[model samples]
Target: MQNKSIGLFLVILILLSACVPTKNIEELAVVTARGVDITEDNQVETMLNIIRFDPEADSLFTSNTGIGNTIKGAREEAADRTSYNLVEGQINLELYGKEAAEQGIFRFINGLIHDSQVSDTMKLAVSNVSAKEIFNIENPNMPAVGEHLDRLIEIEVKNNSFPPATIQDFTRVKTTIGEDPLLPLIGLVDEKPTIIGMAVFQDDRYVVDISLDEGFLMNLFLNKVENKSVEMTLPLQPFEKYKINTIGIESKSLEGEEFHINFLTTHGKSNTKVESLEQLKFKTDTYIEINLTEMSHPISIKHEKAANLLEKEIEKKLKKQYEELFKKVQEANADVFGFGKLYRSKTKDGKITEEEWREKLPYITVDFNVDVKLMHTGTIQ
Candidate 1:
């Protein structure tokens, strides 16, 4: 009787195992990228760039758009139109339009986070024009539209030219208090995927879109991204004899609100006219001073006098720029520089709460001291 019972149980287990359905990879479509936009009527619009294996075409790109009250509803509507199941596990990029981002993208992005099929490692970006416009960019030099955007963002992040924020990072910053989020700015110019700047968000809404230069400065101050190139020009004593050179710099620290950056610069021998060693020294010093100051003025004086004037001008400009950046952050109510974090660190017992920190941040006083050291004068020197 016991042996008969064991046999019956084994048969039942086998039947249950066989009843499980196996997934057919060939019948499912893989999503590579997703774009989110808001229509004029305040409805959510979603576009998915799907990659499917086609025996006739090898790999094909298919776009699907859906409208609904929420992102999940729109996605479901799009999914229903396709014959095969959609696989979002392979998605790599999430692009958001300017209007949609400004309206608060957290609502749409939260849906992706809750979905078990989506990966949190996907990169996030904001489109300067529209996500639809970026999705439509066609370049003969690239493989596909999705691949082009992936490569462009990858290159910028690898070169330290832009800050890389994943969906996970965005979610953390969006929920965290006293901190703002920054997303890469994507531009479609002449139907090409180009990185133009960074979109700054105060909470979940987009506040300011900064140029590449401003973005670089923000990155340097935030100490998030590294590897930067700065150009410096030295004016010779006698008229238009200017020597120009580029330098690679890294941010060392934030002295109060001022940016303290260090660079590996080269000052080389130029074919330009020079009267004396003093003239050369003056021009060289002036160039160094101006570059260190972070000002955009032409060198004015002749001989050694140029060096002094440049130094003073740079010092003044650096102070002014530092003040301006702080004022901008205060007005925007976005602590992109992590001032709140620093304030919390300095508080008594390091136990200040987010609410307490916010109250004290605007009142906190910051001072900056910028120091530039000329390490090398290039191979010629």
Candidate 2:
């Protein structure tokens, strides 16, 4: 009787195994990139670029749009006409239209966070125009739209022109009281998808756009990205020369409200010919002073006794830029530099509220003391 029971159990187990559901790769539509926007009728609009695996083709992708009262509805509508079931597991990037981002993207963000299939590693950005427009851009150099964007962002991250961000990074930054989030701002330039600026967020909503030049400076201050090579071109005067040089920026400290940087320890090779270390320093100093003043930012710096007037002036320019950035943040009520973290460190609770920071921001005055270290001064070989 025991032998009969064992055999019966084995038969039942084999029968039950066939009941488990299975999905083959061909039955699922893998989304490569997703875009969110607000329609003219004020409905939620969703766009997806789907990847098609065709063995003979160089490119494999098609895009479609869906609209509904809510994101879930729109997504379902988009999948209804497709032969395969929609899948979000392969998404590499998420884009938001300016209108959608400005209106507050917390809902969309929360939806993604709650979804089990969608990953947090996917890159997120703000589109300068409609997300649909960016998705529709055509370029022959890329294998597909999705691959083109993937390579584009990868290059920017390597160059430090844009910092790499994942959905997980966005969540942490926005939830923190003293720090805000920044996303890459992309726009179509000459019909090509180009990185134009950074989208600065106050809390969960996009508030401002930082230009490419300003964004580079901001990254240098935060030391947020690794740059393989950083090039700065300035028209040097007072010594009558123009110089294009690469700069090595190392953020010295986590200064509260204002950025404090040390350039003295950082130096890079330049293509411009210079007589000596002194001549290079002189050229860089003049360029810094002229550019900072032209931007209407005044600066002050503390220097070593051995530092010359030119060195001090160059440091002052960095200070000026730092102050200008702080002033802009205060004006926008966004703490992109994690200043709130610094403030909370002093408090007993080690906590900060976004509203409280906004209230206290206007009264905060931060002064920067800058210095520079000149190294690797020579014309690029």
Candidate 3:
């Protein structure tokens, strides 16, 4: 009799478990992406990109705009327009308009970071235009804008096309010296979100735009690249280019005074491509040297010799451009290159804050010792 009773109970429990509650995923307002922009009236405008589901047709996305004095207020307004409560759990990406970010992202990013429901790793970007404008973009090659963006970031980081900048990285760059925060600078191209550069920040304010090539170089400075394809124009051959596909940065070390730097890329590739590889090696070395020496810079580069600092006019014009570039960023007081952090490490005091570092930044001089080596020109396989 007891066995019969237990069996009956077990059957009832199984039946109850089998019956799923009415949970309509389609009715839930899922926020896939968010855009923050500033209106002409100087009010904060929050835009939510929600995926609307349909039972009879393909689910489509829609946008809702809310204007208010604060991000929360604006978001609440947007939520009221929909029957379902807006959820942040599905937000894959968050974008701030150029003007909004320039005003300072600290205000907007703070609340989002504190929300437990929000993914701390969601991809963030600075849009070239108003963040809301990006919603009109669509690319069938990558269906679902939010998922496509998430994939773009995942693939690029995997392929080493750009540095890995997540919530952790973004916050770290903001607080840490010898570093500045950067976000992917994205704009739509033919209805697709395209990465044009890396958005540079000094503290929390948007400072400048680092182009794709410059972004790669900055990643190299940050030692972020691994197994990246390197394509260089053969100098002597002209127009002909060679590729070091699957190149990896073994290690990068920055050492020296605040005024000078010793940037090195070590543990280079170690295989060979052809017989009698000396010529190839020499050519590779020369190419790397010329590339570094001819870098188009913003600031000037000069080494002190015999107690005197002198500029050589005969230096490659391209190298001069790099000097100008560095100088511009330096003068702007944005430590995007992490020189301030390097200075702190090499100091005797053992402590220097970002504020103090910035105060002393304008007076500091800087030079580069950029080097690239070919450990082996060929693959083992």
lDDT of each: 0.64, 0.66, 0.63
Writing each residue's lDDT as its tens digit, candidate 3 over 214-236 gives 66555655544555553322222
Tell me the TM-score of model 3: 0.69
Q: Could you estimate the TM-score for every candidate?
A: 0.71, 0.75, 0.69
- Candidate 1, 119-200: lDDT as tens digits: 9888888998778888866555654566667777877766655556788888887676557788888886666778888888
Where does candidate 3 stray beyond 4 Å?
Answer: 1-24, 53-57, 138-143, 237-325, 376-381
Clashing pairs in 1: none
* Rank order (by TM-score, best first): 2, 1, 3
2 versus 3: better TM-score goes to = 2
- Candidate 1 lowest-lDDT run of ten: 281-290
Instruction: Count clashes in each candidate, considering only residues at least 3 apart in sequence or on different chains.
Output: 0, 5, 29
Q: Candidate 3's error at 188, in angstroms?
A: 3.2
| TM-score of candidate 2 on Cα atoms, chains taken together | 0.75
Candidate number that wins on lDDT, 1 or 2: 2
Compose the digit string of candidate 2's lDDT tens values, residues 154-230.
67766766556678888888998878888888899888888888899998899988876566666655553332333
Q: Candidate 1: where are CA atoms >4 Å away?
A: 1-21, 224-226, 232-322, 348-365
Estimate the lDDT of model 2.
0.66
